[model samples]
Target: METVFLKKGEDRRLRIGHLWVFSNEIDTKRSPLGSFAPGQSVLVADCGGRPLGTGYVNPASLIAVRMVSRKADEVLDASLLHRRLSDALALRERMFRTPFYRLCHGEGDFLPGLVADRHGDHVVCQITTAGMDAHTDELLSVLDSLLHPSSILLDNNVASRDLEGLERFQRVASGDVPEEISVEENGMSYAVPLKNGQKTGWFYDQRVNRAALTPFVQAQQGCSVLDAFCYAGGFGALAAKNGAGKVTFMDASAHALSYAKRNAEQFGTETELLQGDALTLLADLRREGRTFDIVCLDPPAFIKRKKDAKQGLEAYQRVNEIGLDLVRPGGMLMTCSCSHHLEADALRGLVTRAAGKRRRHARLLFQGFQGPDHPIHPAMPETAYLKTFLFHLPE
Candidate 1:
């Protein structure tokens, strides 16, 4: 393999276990990036020519190299993919009784740019980077061998693919893609639209956080819930399964609300489905003096890129302010942020400030994160993205 030498001192993060190598860090004098083809596997080395590891290089992307293995000779092949799948599956099996969790979590599972979420006998994989996209066949073979999944859906329609200079499209790699798939979580069943659904059809990362809502729902008699940004009604379904008296499903997408309504129907829970912008609907609800026993705010990433941090924080504050306003005295508020740019401390502080604006006493009941399936790489903070906070408003 050709060698891609990093500038002196640029190998520090990689040596400490980070998987990404920025474009500017490369020693272009020794190994010009333009000379290598996209997704070309290369041996990374320091300026002195000492080998660092093996990874695939993408000349067009900011993350020029994503190290696959620490060994110089190791390559991302069928053997390596098989071993990584086995290890990731082993951990998930130990953590969950059902085969309904994220099987591969990009860099978290040490397989950068590849995410595979298993939904029963079906596995939906997202290959975001050109490097992983080049190994689609090997990935499919490894997944099939490991799980024998009836279908392997490739949901490559993501914005990140554009950054990698890869075309975005969705296709079934193995068996015929099903219209929908069912999976049990927190003793509740959800009908996930695998083909047209968002983000692998389900967000398994929020599994633990959704499960944490049981006790809160059970403790309140005739509980009312507002599942804001309710995708497929995961949160509202859980509340309904636990005997919530009234559950409102709200989202901007009519497509998402269709499945959320179906899931609610399956749960035999009478729900009010509101289709509109979350902020607008939330404000209307507040104006109508509508209050609930539990209000869940699981909005999409407000801060996608670093530059959007300021505007995203303001957006978060506005939405959360309305969320807090809709919570009655002695009620619960569950808010979440999937933005890696927004830290847990910042979320907590923002929520605190939101509550203070109403002169309400807020007690943080629980702090939650992505489930074990979405393991956080010790050296990569980006891997630990999801943050959840459950707060109680005292009377």
Candidate 2:
């Protein structure tokens, strides 16, 4: 195998268990990135020619190489994929009773650039990196061999794929993909649009966070809730199931709202669907003198890239402030951010700032994170995204 050597001291992070190797870190004079194919496997080494590990190199991407194994001889083949998939499945099975969870969480599962969400008999997978994309057939085979799911859909319509110099497209790698599927979570069944839904058809990362809001909803029987950015109404369904009298579901996609409505109906809860931009709808709701006992602002990642942090923070603050204003005095607000670049403390600070702007006093109630299915690699802080903060507004 070709050996990609890093410059002096550049292997420190890798030595500490980090999995990424950037293009600039490579000792190009010895092993030019251009010499290797996008998904070519190679042995990574230090400046002194000490082998570090095995990984796939992507010359066009910022994350040039994603280490697959610490052993230099480990090949990126079906055996490796099978072992990784089996390990990931074992973890999810241990944590959850039902077969509905994230089966593989990219680097968190030691299979970087791949994410697969299991929904009962169906599995929805997304591959964002060229390295994983190259092994599509092997991944599907391993998944089928392990779980024998009814279907496996590759939802590779993510923008990050473009960065990897890969074309974005969705296809069924195995079996037949149903139009819809249900995943049980926190004693409730959520309707997921598997074929044309967002981010592998469901946000399994927020499973734990959504479940954490139950007590708050149950505290005030018949409390009104506004689930902003309610994709498929996961949060709203939970609130409705827990004796919430009224639940308002809002989202930009009509398709998402349709599913959200279906979920609310399934729960036998009264729901109002608002289809439009969240910020505009939120502002309009405030003008209409509509306030809810529980306001959930689960917006999309406002900050996707590091460069967009400033602008994204502004959007977060504005939406959070409006959400705070729409909360009834003495009610609860469940706000969340899925941006990996945004830290928990930073989110807290922004929420504090937003509260001050609205002249409201909030008592921090609960701090939430992604479900156990999405494990965090200790060396990689990037794996620890999805911050959910629940606060109580004093009367």
Candidate 3:
């Protein structure tokens, strides 16, 4: 195997099990990166000639190397893919009673830059790395041999692909997938549009968090609920089904609000879907003097990059303040941040700052991470990103 040498003391991240090797850390003079192909597997070693691991190198990308294996004899091939995929499946089966869950969560499952979401008989896969992109055929065959879902759709429109010099496209990979499919989440049925929906048609990561709201919903019957940044009414629908007197969903996407309405209707629950920006909607609701007994603020990633951290924290604080203001005294506020860059403590601080700005005291009730299906990788902290906090506002 070809070898790529890094400068002395530059293999610290790889020694600690982090998979990525940045371009700046490599010794270009000894092992010029331009000679390596995009997805060619190469032995990674330190300057003193000690083998670190075998990883795929991408000369065109800033992430110079993505480690595939630490063992000396291991090779990146179909057999390795099959073994890793099978191991990922075994872990999920042990944790979940149902097949409807995330099958592979990129780095979390040890298969970097790959995601697979299972929807009963169908599986949606997204490949975002050149290494994984080169092995699409092998991956499809492995998925066919293992889970054997009725169909597999490749949702490869993620923006991360651009960084790896990949084109964006979505198509049926294996079998014919229907436009609409039904899956059971937390014992509730939701009909999702796979071809025309967001992130494999469902947000399975928040399944556990949505289920946690049942108790709060049941206790606050006849109470008005507001689900801001609601996607397909997951939280609002649950609240309505659990007996919220009125559920109002606010989302910027008309398409998302449409799905939310369909979900609410399918579940025989009534929800008012408002199509508008979450921040603007909150301001409008506050001006209208409309208060809710329960408010859920589940926004998308406010901080996509490290540079946006400060602005994103302020955004979180502002939206959370709006959410707290709209909540009736003694109501519940369920806030969430999907930004992996933002730590739980940072989010908690933002919530506290928002509460202080509103001159309200909030008692922490519960906090949660991503669902079990999306397991956290011990070596990579980025795998465990989602954070949800439930607070009780004083009357």
lDDT of each: 0.92, 0.91, 0.87
Name the weakest run of 10 consecutive residues (lDDT summed) in model 3: 262-271
Residue 211 error for model 1, in Å? Answer: 0.9
Clashing pairs in 3: none
What is the per-residue lDDT of model 2 for residues 278-301, given as tens digits with 9 covering 90 to 100? 999999998998999999999999
Query: In candidate 1, residue 219 scores what lDDT?
Result: 87
Better of 1 and 3 by lDDT: 1
Q: What TM-score would candidate 3 get against the native?
A: 0.97
TM-score of each: 0.98, 0.98, 0.97
Q: Write the per-residue lDDT of candidate 3 for residues 1-395, one digit (tens) a residue.
A: 78899998998888988988899999999889998888888899999989998888888888888888997667668888899899989988897788899999887777777899999889999999898888999999999999888999999998989999999999899889889888788777776778888888889999889998889889977778888888778888777778887788899888788877776666456678888878988999899998989999999999998999889988888898788889999899999999999999988887788888778899998999899889887778877799999999987
lDDT of 1 by residue, 157-210 (tens): 999999999999999899989998897888878888889899999998888899
Best model per lDDT: 1
